[model samples]
Target: MKVAVLALQGAFIEHEQVLQRLGVETVEIRQLKDWQQPIDALILPGGESTVQMRLLKELGLYEPIREAILIGMPVLGTCAGMILLSEGRLGTMDIEVRRNAYGRQLGSFHTVDTVKGIGTDVPMTFIRAPYIERVLSDKVEVLSTVDGHIVAARQGNQLATAFHPELDDGTRLHELFLGMVVGRSDKE
Candidate 1:
Protein backbone atom coordinates (compact mmCIF):
# COMPACT_ATOMS: atom_id res chain seq x y z
CA MET A 1 0.00 0.00 0.00
CA LYS A 2 1.09 3.57 -0.59
CA VAL A 3 1.74 5.80 2.42
CA ALA A 4 2.59 9.51 2.58
CA VAL A 5 4.85 10.88 5.28
CA LEU A 6 4.59 14.58 6.04
CA ALA A 7 7.99 15.93 5.03
CA LEU A 8 7.60 19.52 6.05
CA GLN A 9 10.19 18.98 8.79
CA GLY A 10 11.38 16.71 11.60
CA ALA A 11 12.23 12.99 11.31
CA PHE A 12 9.99 12.36 8.34
CA ILE A 13 12.80 10.74 6.38
CA GLU A 14 13.28 8.18 9.14
CA HIS A 15 9.64 7.25 8.98
CA GLU A 16 9.85 6.89 5.21
CA GLN A 17 12.89 4.64 5.54
CA VAL A 18 11.16 2.41 8.08
CA LEU A 19 8.02 2.18 5.95
CA GLN A 20 10.11 1.36 2.90
CA ARG A 21 11.80 -1.42 4.88
CA LEU A 22 8.34 -2.79 5.58
CA GLY A 23 7.84 -3.20 1.83
CA VAL A 24 5.36 -0.34 1.55
CA GLU A 25 5.50 2.34 -1.11
CA THR A 26 6.16 5.69 0.55
CA VAL A 27 6.08 9.35 -0.47
CA GLU A 28 7.18 12.57 1.20
CA ILE A 29 4.28 14.95 1.50
CA ARG A 30 5.21 18.58 0.92
CA GLN A 31 2.22 20.31 -0.68
CA LEU A 32 -1.48 19.86 -0.31
CA LYS A 33 -1.52 18.78 -3.94
CA ASP A 34 0.45 15.73 -2.90
CA TRP A 35 -2.42 14.61 -0.71
CA GLN A 36 -4.60 14.26 -3.80
CA GLN A 37 -2.67 11.19 -4.83
CA PRO A 38 -4.28 7.86 -4.11
CA ILE A 39 -2.57 6.64 -0.93
CA ASP A 40 -3.80 4.08 1.52
CA ALA A 41 -2.42 5.82 4.58
CA LEU A 42 -0.47 8.79 5.96
CA ILE A 43 2.11 9.31 8.69
CA LEU A 44 2.85 12.57 10.53
CA PRO A 45 6.36 12.41 11.92
CA GLY A 46 7.56 14.09 15.09
CA GLY A 47 8.38 17.81 14.81
CA GLU A 48 7.65 21.22 16.33
CA SER A 49 3.86 21.41 16.55
CA THR A 50 3.65 25.20 16.19
CA VAL A 51 5.77 25.18 13.07
CA GLN A 52 3.99 22.16 11.67
CA MET A 53 0.66 23.82 12.28
CA ARG A 54 1.79 26.97 10.51
CA LEU A 55 3.01 24.94 7.56
CA LEU A 56 -0.25 23.06 7.41
CA LYS A 57 -2.13 26.32 7.37
CA GLU A 58 0.13 27.82 4.74
CA LEU A 59 -0.32 24.75 2.57
CA GLY A 60 -4.07 24.77 3.17
CA LEU A 61 -3.87 21.23 4.57
CA TYR A 62 -5.21 21.82 8.06
CA GLU A 63 -8.82 21.46 7.03
CA PRO A 64 -8.08 18.80 4.46
CA ILE A 65 -6.41 16.69 7.13
CA ARG A 66 -9.25 17.18 9.54
CA GLU A 67 -11.72 16.31 6.82
CA ALA A 68 -9.78 13.22 5.90
CA ILE A 69 -9.81 12.04 9.47
CA LEU A 70 -13.55 12.61 9.57
CA ILE A 71 -13.91 10.58 6.39
CA GLY A 72 -11.84 7.70 7.82
CA MET A 73 -8.41 8.12 6.26
CA PRO A 74 -6.02 6.21 8.45
CA VAL A 75 -3.36 8.52 9.94
CA LEU A 76 -0.53 7.72 12.33
CA GLY A 77 1.14 10.56 14.25
CA THR A 78 4.24 10.46 16.42
CA CYS A 79 5.54 12.88 19.08
CA ALA A 80 4.88 16.41 17.88
CA GLY A 81 2.62 14.88 15.30
CA MET A 82 0.62 13.41 18.14
CA ILE A 83 0.29 16.84 19.66
CA LEU A 84 -1.17 18.09 16.42
CA LEU A 85 -3.77 15.34 16.37
CA SER A 86 -4.84 15.95 19.92
CA GLU A 87 -8.06 17.92 20.41
CA GLY A 88 -6.22 19.74 23.19
CA ARG A 89 -2.57 20.37 24.08
CA LEU A 90 -0.83 20.87 27.46
CA GLY A 91 2.07 23.22 26.80
CA THR A 92 2.43 26.89 27.70
CA MET A 93 1.37 27.80 24.20
CA ASP A 94 -2.10 29.17 23.51
CA ILE A 95 -3.18 25.61 22.87
CA GLU A 96 -3.19 23.35 25.89
CA VAL A 97 -0.14 21.07 25.60
CA ARG A 98 2.12 19.61 28.22
CA ARG A 99 5.24 20.72 26.45
CA ASN A 100 8.35 18.68 27.22
CA ALA A 101 6.44 16.63 29.74
CA TYR A 102 8.92 13.85 29.15
CA GLY A 103 11.72 16.35 29.79
CA ARG A 104 14.34 17.50 27.27
CA GLN A 105 15.93 15.62 24.41
CA LEU A 106 18.94 14.83 26.61
CA GLY A 107 16.55 13.11 28.96
CA SER A 108 15.34 10.81 26.22
CA PHE A 109 15.49 7.10 27.03
CA HIS A 110 14.32 3.69 25.89
CA THR A 111 11.62 1.52 27.39
CA VAL A 112 10.24 -1.94 26.74
CA ASP A 113 6.66 -2.69 27.57
CA THR A 114 3.44 -3.92 25.99
CA VAL A 115 1.42 -1.16 24.34
CA LYS A 116 -2.28 -1.72 24.84
CA GLY A 117 -3.25 -2.66 21.27
CA ILE A 118 0.15 -2.88 19.56
CA GLY A 119 0.91 -6.06 21.53
CA THR A 120 4.08 -7.20 23.34
CA ASP A 121 6.75 -4.99 24.92
CA VAL A 122 8.02 -2.65 22.23
CA PRO A 123 11.02 -0.41 22.59
CA MET A 124 9.74 3.19 22.48
CA THR A 125 11.83 6.33 22.12
CA PHE A 126 10.59 9.56 23.63
CA ILE A 127 12.13 12.97 22.95
CA ARG A 128 10.22 15.77 24.60
CA ALA A 129 7.06 13.71 24.07
CA PRO A 130 3.62 15.00 25.00
CA TYR A 131 1.17 12.96 27.01
CA ILE A 132 -2.59 12.87 26.49
CA GLU A 133 -4.19 14.81 29.28
CA ARG A 134 -7.79 14.17 28.26
CA VAL A 135 -9.22 12.37 25.25
CA LEU A 136 -12.03 14.53 23.81
CA SER A 137 -14.26 11.75 22.66
CA ASP A 138 -15.03 8.04 22.89
CA LYS A 139 -13.85 7.71 19.31
CA VAL A 140 -10.32 7.91 20.64
CA GLU A 141 -9.13 4.55 21.94
CA VAL A 142 -6.09 4.26 24.19
CA LEU A 143 -3.34 2.09 22.72
CA SER A 144 -0.35 2.43 25.06
CA THR A 145 1.00 4.22 28.11
CA VAL A 146 4.26 4.74 30.00
CA ASP A 147 2.83 5.43 33.39
CA GLY A 148 -0.81 6.37 34.07
CA HIS A 149 -0.71 8.93 31.28
CA ILE A 150 -2.02 7.96 27.86
CA VAL A 151 0.75 7.56 25.28
CA ALA A 152 -1.02 6.11 22.25
CA ALA A 153 -4.58 6.33 21.02
CA ARG A 154 -6.77 5.70 17.96
CA GLN A 155 -9.74 7.83 17.03
CA GLY A 156 -11.55 5.92 14.33
CA ASN A 157 -9.28 6.04 11.26
CA GLN A 158 -6.73 8.20 13.12
CA LEU A 159 -3.93 6.69 15.20
CA ALA A 160 -1.42 8.69 17.28
CA THR A 161 1.57 7.92 19.49
CA ALA A 162 3.56 10.01 21.93
CA PHE A 163 6.67 7.92 21.29
CA HIS A 164 8.74 7.21 18.21
CA PRO A 165 8.30 3.62 17.09
CA GLU A 166 10.38 4.04 13.93
CA LEU A 167 13.58 4.43 15.95
CA ASP A 168 13.40 0.76 16.93
CA ASP A 169 13.83 -2.42 14.91
CA GLY A 170 10.33 -3.58 15.70
CA THR A 171 7.67 -3.10 13.01
CA ARG A 172 4.58 -4.00 15.00
CA LEU A 173 3.20 -0.45 14.98
CA HIS A 174 3.93 0.03 11.29
CA GLU A 175 2.38 -3.35 10.58
CA LEU A 176 -0.72 -2.38 12.49
CA PHE A 177 -1.07 0.85 10.49
CA LEU A 178 -0.68 -1.11 7.28
CA GLY A 179 -3.44 -3.41 8.42
CA MET A 180 -5.67 -0.44 9.06
CA VAL A 181 -4.99 0.94 5.60
CA VAL A 182 -5.64 -2.44 4.00
CA GLY A 183 -8.80 -2.88 6.00
CA ARG A 184 -10.09 0.53 4.95
CA SER A 185 -9.22 -0.08 1.29
CA ASP A 186 -11.01 -3.41 1.27
CA LYS A 187 -14.16 -1.76 2.52
CA GLU A 188 -13.98 0.65 -0.39
Candidate 2:
Protein backbone atom coordinates (compact mmCIF):
# COMPACT_ATOMS: atom_id res chain seq x y z
CA MET A 1 0.00 0.00 0.00
CA LYS A 2 1.09 3.58 -0.62
CA VAL A 3 1.56 5.87 2.36
CA ALA A 4 2.35 9.57 2.42
CA VAL A 5 4.33 11.27 5.19
CA LEU A 6 3.87 14.98 5.79
CA ALA A 7 7.29 16.47 5.00
CA LEU A 8 6.63 20.08 5.78
CA GLN A 9 9.02 19.76 8.76
CA GLY A 10 9.98 17.62 11.75
CA ALA A 11 11.03 13.98 11.67
CA PHE A 12 9.05 13.14 8.54
CA ILE A 13 12.08 11.57 6.91
CA GLU A 14 12.34 9.11 9.78
CA HIS A 15 8.73 8.07 9.30
CA GLU A 16 9.38 7.59 5.59
CA GLN A 17 12.38 5.42 6.39
CA VAL A 18 10.31 3.24 8.73
CA LEU A 19 7.55 2.86 6.16
CA GLN A 20 10.15 1.94 3.57
CA ARG A 21 11.54 -0.65 5.96
CA LEU A 22 8.10 -2.23 6.07
CA GLY A 23 8.30 -2.50 2.27
CA VAL A 24 5.48 -0.07 1.78
CA GLU A 25 5.58 2.53 -0.99
CA THR A 26 6.02 5.95 0.63
CA VAL A 27 5.78 9.55 -0.49
CA GLU A 28 6.91 12.78 1.15
CA ILE A 29 4.16 15.37 1.31
CA ARG A 30 5.46 18.89 0.69
CA GLN A 31 2.35 20.50 -0.81
CA LEU A 32 -1.37 20.17 -1.02
CA LYS A 33 -0.69 18.95 -4.52
CA ASP A 34 1.01 15.97 -2.94
CA TRP A 35 -2.34 15.05 -1.40
CA GLN A 36 -3.79 14.88 -4.90
CA GLN A 37 -2.08 11.57 -5.41
CA PRO A 38 -3.81 8.42 -4.18
CA ILE A 39 -2.56 7.18 -0.83
CA ASP A 40 -3.76 4.40 1.38
CA ALA A 41 -2.56 6.14 4.53
CA LEU A 42 -0.79 9.25 5.82
CA ILE A 43 1.54 10.13 8.71
CA LEU A 44 2.00 13.47 10.43
CA PRO A 45 5.40 13.32 12.09
CA GLY A 46 6.42 15.04 15.33
CA GLY A 47 7.29 18.71 15.00
CA GLU A 48 6.41 22.14 16.26
CA SER A 49 2.64 22.36 16.04
CA THR A 50 2.79 26.09 15.52
CA VAL A 51 4.99 25.76 12.49
CA GLN A 52 3.14 22.76 11.15
CA MET A 53 -0.17 24.60 11.46
CA ARG A 54 1.22 27.63 9.68
CA LEU A 55 2.57 25.46 6.90
CA LEU A 56 -0.79 23.75 6.64
CA LYS A 57 -2.45 27.11 6.31
CA GLU A 58 0.12 28.29 3.75
CA LEU A 59 -0.43 25.12 1.72
CA GLY A 60 -4.22 25.19 2.16
CA LEU A 61 -4.16 21.74 3.68
CA TYR A 62 -5.87 22.30 7.02
CA GLU A 63 -9.39 21.90 5.72
CA PRO A 64 -8.38 19.21 3.27
CA ILE A 65 -6.89 17.18 6.07
CA ARG A 66 -9.97 17.58 8.23
CA GLU A 67 -12.17 16.59 5.31
CA ALA A 68 -10.01 13.58 4.58
CA ILE A 69 -10.29 12.45 8.20
CA LEU A 70 -14.04 12.81 8.01
CA ILE A 71 -14.05 10.63 4.93
CA GLY A 72 -12.11 7.87 6.77
CA MET A 73 -8.58 8.27 5.44
CA PRO A 74 -6.22 6.57 7.85
CA VAL A 75 -3.84 9.07 9.52
CA LEU A 76 -1.16 8.68 12.17
CA GLY A 77 0.06 11.71 14.11
CA THR A 78 3.00 11.72 16.51
CA CYS A 79 3.94 14.25 19.23
CA ALA A 80 3.02 17.68 17.87
CA GLY A 81 1.06 15.83 15.28
CA MET A 82 -0.91 14.28 18.17
CA ILE A 83 -1.82 17.74 19.43
CA LEU A 84 -3.40 18.52 16.09
CA LEU A 85 -5.71 15.51 16.15
CA SER A 86 -7.28 16.23 19.49
CA GLU A 87 -10.60 18.05 19.85
CA GLY A 88 -8.88 20.65 22.00
CA ARG A 89 -5.56 21.31 23.75
CA LEU A 90 -4.37 22.33 27.22
CA GLY A 91 -2.52 25.58 26.59
CA THR A 92 -2.43 28.17 23.79
CA MET A 93 -1.25 25.75 21.17
CA ASP A 94 -0.38 27.24 17.81
CA ILE A 95 -3.48 25.43 16.62
CA GLU A 96 -4.50 24.58 20.18
CA VAL A 97 -2.00 22.15 21.70
CA ARG A 98 -1.22 20.97 25.24
CA ARG A 99 2.35 22.34 25.09
CA ASN A 100 5.19 20.74 27.09
CA ALA A 101 2.82 18.35 28.81
CA TYR A 102 5.53 15.75 28.90
CA GLY A 103 8.13 18.26 29.97
CA ARG A 104 10.98 19.45 27.72
CA GLN A 105 12.66 17.73 24.81
CA LEU A 106 15.56 16.83 27.06
CA GLY A 107 13.11 14.97 29.28
CA SER A 108 12.18 12.69 26.38
CA PHE A 109 12.73 9.00 26.86
CA HIS A 110 11.48 5.50 26.04
CA THR A 111 9.04 3.45 28.09
CA VAL A 112 7.36 0.07 28.03
CA ASP A 113 3.80 0.58 29.13
CA THR A 114 0.48 -1.16 28.76
CA VAL A 115 -2.00 0.46 26.45
CA LYS A 116 -5.77 -0.03 26.58
CA GLY A 117 -6.38 -1.86 23.33
CA ILE A 118 -2.99 -2.33 21.57
CA GLY A 119 -0.95 -4.48 23.99
CA THR A 120 1.14 -4.59 27.14
CA ASP A 121 4.43 -2.91 27.92
CA VAL A 122 4.95 -1.64 24.42
CA PRO A 123 8.06 0.43 23.94
CA MET A 124 7.10 4.05 23.32
CA THR A 125 9.45 6.96 22.72
CA PHE A 126 8.37 10.37 23.93
CA ILE A 127 9.95 13.71 23.05
CA ARG A 128 8.20 16.71 24.46
CA ALA A 129 4.95 14.85 23.92
CA PRO A 130 1.47 16.16 24.51
CA TYR A 131 -0.92 14.23 26.67
CA ILE A 132 -4.57 13.79 25.70
CA GLU A 133 -6.50 15.70 28.33
CA ARG A 134 -9.94 14.73 27.05
CA VAL A 135 -11.61 12.89 24.22
CA LEU A 136 -14.46 14.71 22.48
CA SER A 137 -16.40 11.78 21.14
CA ASP A 138 -17.09 8.07 21.35
CA LYS A 139 -15.74 7.72 17.83
CA VAL A 140 -12.29 8.08 19.38
CA GLU A 141 -10.76 5.18 21.33
CA VAL A 142 -7.75 5.33 23.59
CA LEU A 143 -5.10 2.91 22.41
CA SER A 144 -2.25 3.52 24.81
CA THR A 145 -1.20 5.54 27.81
CA VAL A 146 1.61 6.20 30.28
CA ASP A 147 1.01 6.90 33.95
CA GLY A 148 -2.73 7.23 33.24
CA HIS A 149 -2.19 9.92 30.61
CA ILE A 150 -3.61 9.07 27.25
CA VAL A 151 -0.79 8.76 24.71
CA ALA A 152 -2.47 7.06 21.78
CA ALA A 153 -6.00 7.19 20.40
CA ARG A 154 -7.98 6.19 17.35
CA GLN A 155 -10.96 8.04 15.98
CA GLY A 156 -12.43 5.94 13.24
CA ASN A 157 -9.72 5.67 10.60
CA GLN A 158 -7.61 8.37 12.21
CA LEU A 159 -4.89 7.47 14.71
CA ALA A 160 -2.79 9.76 16.90
CA THR A 161 0.12 8.99 19.19
CA ALA A 162 2.09 11.13 21.60
CA PHE A 163 5.23 9.05 21.16
CA HIS A 164 7.46 8.45 18.16
CA PRO A 165 6.64 4.92 17.12
CA GLU A 166 8.91 5.15 14.08
CA LEU A 167 12.02 5.86 16.15
CA ASP A 168 11.51 2.69 18.18
CA ASP A 169 11.94 0.15 15.36
CA GLY A 170 8.61 -1.31 16.43
CA THR A 171 6.44 -1.84 13.37
CA ARG A 172 3.36 -2.91 15.33
CA LEU A 173 1.82 0.53 15.21
CA HIS A 174 2.51 0.87 11.50
CA GLU A 175 1.12 -2.58 10.99
CA LEU A 176 -1.98 -1.56 12.92
CA PHE A 177 -2.41 1.42 10.61
CA LEU A 178 -1.94 -0.76 7.59
CA GLY A 179 -4.63 -3.01 8.97
CA MET A 180 -6.94 -0.03 9.20
CA VAL A 181 -6.27 0.78 5.54
CA VAL A 182 -6.84 -2.78 4.50
CA GLY A 183 -9.97 -3.14 6.60
CA ARG A 184 -11.43 0.06 5.21
CA SER A 185 -10.80 -1.09 1.66
CA ASP A 186 -12.36 -4.46 2.28
CA LYS A 187 -15.52 -2.88 3.60
CA GLU A 188 -15.79 -0.72 0.52
Candidate 3:
Protein backbone atom coordinates (compact mmCIF):
# COMPACT_ATOMS: atom_id res chain seq x y z
CA MET A 1 0.00 0.00 0.00
CA LYS A 2 1.05 3.58 -0.59
CA VAL A 3 1.32 6.32 2.02
CA ALA A 4 1.81 10.06 1.90
CA VAL A 5 4.47 11.76 4.02
CA LEU A 6 4.26 15.48 4.61
CA ALA A 7 7.68 16.67 3.41
CA LEU A 8 7.31 20.40 3.77
CA GLN A 9 9.55 20.31 6.85
CA GLY A 10 10.99 18.38 9.78
CA ALA A 11 12.25 14.78 9.95
CA PHE A 12 10.07 13.64 7.09
CA ILE A 13 12.82 11.73 5.28
CA GLU A 14 13.44 9.64 8.37
CA HIS A 15 9.82 8.61 8.36
CA GLU A 16 10.00 7.77 4.68
CA GLN A 17 13.01 5.55 5.36
CA VAL A 18 11.09 3.66 8.01
CA LEU A 19 8.19 3.19 5.65
CA GLN A 20 10.51 2.00 2.92
CA ARG A 21 12.10 -0.54 5.22
CA LEU A 22 8.61 -1.83 5.94
CA GLY A 23 8.22 -2.38 2.16
CA VAL A 24 5.60 0.31 1.87
CA GLU A 25 5.33 2.73 -1.05
CA THR A 26 5.59 6.38 0.00
CA VAL A 27 4.93 9.72 -1.63
CA GLU A 28 6.34 12.97 -0.37
CA ILE A 29 3.59 15.52 -0.06
CA ARG A 30 4.89 19.08 -0.49
CA GLN A 31 2.32 20.51 -2.86
CA LEU A 32 -1.36 20.23 -3.75
CA LYS A 33 -0.64 17.78 -6.53
CA ASP A 34 1.15 15.50 -4.11
CA TRP A 35 -2.00 15.30 -2.00
CA GLN A 36 -3.98 14.27 -5.08
CA GLN A 37 -1.97 11.08 -5.43
CA PRO A 38 -3.58 7.81 -4.37
CA ILE A 39 -2.56 6.66 -0.95
CA ASP A 40 -3.92 4.56 1.89
CA ALA A 41 -2.46 6.62 4.74
CA LEU A 42 -0.54 9.78 5.68
CA ILE A 43 2.31 10.55 8.02
CA LEU A 44 2.87 13.92 9.64
CA PRO A 45 6.45 13.80 10.86
CA GLY A 46 8.10 15.50 13.82
CA GLY A 47 8.86 19.20 13.27
CA GLU A 48 8.36 22.75 14.51
CA SER A 49 4.57 23.02 14.80
CA THR A 50 4.30 26.77 14.35
CA VAL A 51 6.40 26.85 11.23
CA GLN A 52 4.67 23.81 9.81
CA MET A 53 1.29 25.38 10.49
CA ARG A 54 2.24 28.62 8.77
CA LEU A 55 3.71 26.76 5.81
CA LEU A 56 0.61 24.62 5.47
CA LYS A 57 -1.54 27.74 5.03
CA GLU A 58 0.96 29.75 3.02
CA LEU A 59 1.40 26.84 0.61
CA GLY A 60 -2.41 26.42 0.35
CA LEU A 61 -2.34 22.82 1.59
CA TYR A 62 -3.92 23.35 5.00
CA GLU A 63 -7.61 23.08 4.18
CA PRO A 64 -7.57 20.06 1.90
CA ILE A 65 -5.35 18.01 4.15
CA ARG A 66 -7.36 19.05 7.20
CA GLU A 67 -10.60 18.09 5.53
CA ALA A 68 -9.21 14.72 4.39
CA ILE A 69 -8.14 13.97 7.97
CA LEU A 70 -11.53 14.99 9.35
CA ILE A 71 -13.27 12.69 6.90
CA GLY A 72 -11.18 9.70 8.06
CA MET A 73 -8.02 9.47 6.00
CA PRO A 74 -5.91 7.41 8.37
CA VAL A 75 -3.08 9.56 9.72
CA LEU A 76 -0.10 8.94 12.01
CA GLY A 77 1.28 12.09 13.61
CA THR A 78 4.55 12.24 15.51
CA CYS A 79 5.62 15.05 17.84
CA ALA A 80 4.67 18.41 16.33
CA GLY A 81 2.41 16.51 13.99
CA MET A 82 0.42 15.52 17.09
CA ILE A 83 0.06 19.15 18.03
CA LEU A 84 -1.24 19.92 14.56
CA LEU A 85 -3.98 17.28 14.82
CA SER A 86 -5.43 18.43 18.12
CA GLU A 87 -9.09 19.47 18.09
CA GLY A 88 -10.56 22.96 17.55
CA ARG A 89 -7.23 23.46 15.88
CA LEU A 90 -5.38 22.80 12.68
CA GLY A 91 -6.41 19.14 12.33
CA THR A 92 -9.21 16.83 13.60
CA MET A 93 -8.04 14.68 16.49
CA ASP A 94 -10.10 15.44 19.62
CA ILE A 95 -7.39 16.43 22.05
CA GLU A 96 -5.53 19.46 23.36
CA VAL A 97 -1.73 19.46 22.92
CA ARG A 98 0.80 21.71 24.54
CA ARG A 99 3.49 22.50 22.02
CA ASN A 100 6.99 21.52 23.16
CA ALA A 101 5.50 20.29 26.43
CA TYR A 102 8.83 18.59 27.07
CA GLY A 103 10.75 21.89 26.68
CA ARG A 104 13.44 22.80 24.13
CA GLN A 105 16.29 20.83 22.54
CA LEU A 106 18.31 20.44 25.74
CA GLY A 107 15.26 18.95 27.40
CA SER A 108 15.05 16.28 24.72
CA PHE A 109 15.46 12.67 25.79
CA HIS A 110 15.05 9.00 24.89
CA THR A 111 13.45 6.00 26.60
CA VAL A 112 11.99 2.59 25.98
CA ASP A 113 8.36 2.41 27.05
CA THR A 114 5.39 0.09 26.60
CA VAL A 115 2.97 1.53 24.08
CA LYS A 116 -0.25 -0.11 25.26
CA GLY A 117 -1.17 -2.23 22.24
CA ILE A 118 2.25 -1.80 20.74
CA GLY A 119 4.04 -3.74 23.51
CA THR A 120 7.14 -3.04 25.60
CA ASP A 121 10.78 -2.28 24.73
CA VAL A 122 9.61 0.34 22.34
CA PRO A 123 12.24 2.97 21.73
CA MET A 124 10.89 6.50 22.04
CA THR A 125 12.86 9.56 21.02
CA PHE A 126 11.46 12.86 22.19
CA ILE A 127 12.87 16.03 20.68
CA ARG A 128 11.05 19.18 21.57
CA ALA A 129 7.95 17.02 21.70
CA PRO A 130 4.42 17.85 22.75
CA TYR A 131 2.22 15.59 24.82
CA ILE A 132 -1.53 15.39 24.90
CA GLU A 133 -2.73 17.42 27.86
CA ARG A 134 -6.27 16.05 27.68
CA VAL A 135 -8.61 14.05 25.49
CA LEU A 136 -11.33 16.47 24.44
CA SER A 137 -13.77 13.72 23.51
CA ASP A 138 -14.83 10.25 24.62
CA LYS A 139 -13.73 8.88 21.29
CA VAL A 140 -10.11 9.60 22.06
CA GLU A 141 -8.25 6.55 23.44
CA VAL A 142 -4.99 6.78 25.29
CA LEU A 143 -2.41 4.37 23.91
CA SER A 144 0.76 5.00 25.91
CA THR A 145 2.22 7.03 28.70
CA VAL A 146 5.70 7.94 29.86
CA ASP A 147 6.65 9.53 33.16
CA GLY A 148 2.93 9.94 33.98
CA HIS A 149 2.40 11.97 30.84
CA ILE A 150 0.20 10.95 27.93
CA VAL A 151 2.43 10.30 24.92
CA ALA A 152 0.33 8.33 22.45
CA ALA A 153 -3.38 8.24 21.60
CA ARG A 154 -5.88 7.33 18.94
CA GLN A 155 -9.26 8.68 17.89
CA GLY A 156 -11.04 7.10 14.93
CA ASN A 157 -8.76 7.20 11.91
CA GLN A 158 -6.14 9.28 13.71
CA LEU A 159 -3.10 8.00 15.62
CA ALA A 160 -0.68 10.39 17.32
CA THR A 161 2.49 10.00 19.33
CA ALA A 162 4.52 12.66 21.08
CA PHE A 163 7.68 10.67 20.45
CA HIS A 164 9.49 10.16 17.18
CA PRO A 165 8.97 6.48 16.40
CA GLU A 166 10.82 6.97 13.14
CA LEU A 167 13.97 7.92 14.98
CA ASP A 168 14.09 4.60 16.80
CA ASP A 169 14.86 1.04 15.70
CA GLY A 170 11.32 -0.19 16.35
CA THR A 171 8.85 -0.63 13.51
CA ARG A 172 5.80 -1.37 15.65
CA LEU A 173 4.34 2.13 15.32
CA HIS A 174 4.73 2.16 11.54
CA GLU A 175 3.39 -1.38 11.34
CA LEU A 176 0.43 -0.32 13.46
CA PHE A 177 -0.36 2.54 11.08
CA LEU A 178 -0.02 0.27 8.07
CA GLY A 179 -2.42 -2.12 9.75
CA MET A 180 -4.86 0.72 10.16
CA VAL A 181 -4.52 1.51 6.50
CA VAL A 182 -5.13 -2.09 5.48
CA GLY A 183 -8.03 -2.47 7.88
CA ARG A 184 -9.62 0.66 6.44
CA SER A 185 -9.23 -0.54 2.88
CA ASP A 186 -10.62 -3.98 3.69
CA LYS A 187 -13.72 -2.44 5.23
CA GLU A 188 -14.25 -0.35 2.14
Instruction: Give the top-scoring candidate (TM-score).
Output: 3
Model 3 spans with C-alpha error above 4 angstroms? none
Please identify which of the two predictions, 1 or 3, would achieve the higher lDDT against the true structure.
Answer: 3
Order the numbered candidates by TM-score, best leading. 3, 1, 2
TM-score for candidate 2: 0.91
Error of 1 at 154 (Å): 1.2
Question: Clashing residue pairs, candidate 1?
Answer: 89-96, 89-97, 90-96, 90-97, 90-98, 91-97, 91-98, 113-121
lDDT of 3 by residue, 1-188 (tens): 88999999999999999999999999999988888878788998888888888888888889999988877899999998998898655749889988888889998999998987789899999998899998888999999999888999999889999999999888999999888899899999
TM-score of 3: 0.97
Q: Please, what are the lDDT tens digits per residue for candidate 2 over residues 1-188? A: 89988899999988888888889999888888888988888888898988888888889888887777667788888888887666542211212236678689787888988765567767899998888877766666778767888888877777788898888867788888888988998988
Worst 10 residues of 1 by lDDT: 88-97
Q: Which scores higher on lDDT, 1 or 2?
A: 1
Q: Once superposed on the true structure, which residue ranges of model 1 sit more than 4 Å away at CA?
A: 88-97
Weakest 10 consecutive residues of candidate 2 by summed lDDT: 88-97
Candidate No. with top lDDT = 3
Error of 3 at 65 (Å): 0.6
Local distance difference test scores for all models: 0.79, 0.79, 0.90
Candidate 2 runs further than 4 Å off: 88-97
